[model samples]
Target: MLRNRVRELRARHGYSQTALANRVDVTRQTIGFIEKGEFSPSITLSLKLAKELQISVDELFWLEEDLDE
Candidate 1:
């Protein structure tokens, strides 16, 4: 499974779901699903999110098994 710190980072950046979605050119529900771990964004989307959040993609997301490392 892919895990993300989208919610935390989004909050730290002071963006609402709609705000981030608009910046990322996705729907608010898409952001919601991503935050809830119900959706794994495409690489392009991930890059966009990381850019908007001013972080690296690796910092924003990781595989579930990576937690063991």
Candidate 2:
């Protein structure tokens, strides 16, 4: 599964969902979905998020391998 630190970063940056969404050019619901792991962002969007959060994509997102997998 795709694991992300979007919520953590957003909080650390003192940004609300709507604020971050506006910076990333997406709907607040999209930011909410991303935080909830209900959606995966495209590469471009991921880069934008990473940039806005002042971190690298690797730091923002990673793959979590399930034991069964």
Candidate 3:
């Protein structure tokens, strides 16, 4: 499974789901799903999100097992 710190970073950047979604040209629900780990974004979308949140893609998303390392 893919895990992310999207919610935390979004909050730290003072952005609501709607706001972030707008910046990334996606829907608010998409942001919600991403935050909940119910969806995995495409590489293009991931790059856009990382750009908007001022972080790298690797910092934003990771594999579930990566946490065990």
Return the TM-score for each candidate structure.
Answer: 0.92, 0.93, 0.92
Tens digit per residue, CA lDDT, model 3, 1-69? 899999999999999999999999999999999999999999999999999999999999998764555
Cα lDDT of all candidates, in order? 0.96, 0.95, 0.96
lDDT of 2 by residue, 13-59 (tens): 99999999999999999999999887999999999999999999999
Q: Write the per-residue lDDT of candidate 1 for residues 5-58, one digit (tens) a residue.
A: 999999999999999999999999999999998899999999999999999999
Regions of model 2 farther than 4 Å from truth: 67-69
Off by over 4 Å in 3: 66-69
lDDT of 2: 0.95
The superposed Cα distance between candidate 1 and the true structure at residue 40, in angstroms, equals: 0.6
Which candidate achieves the best TM-score against the true structure? 2
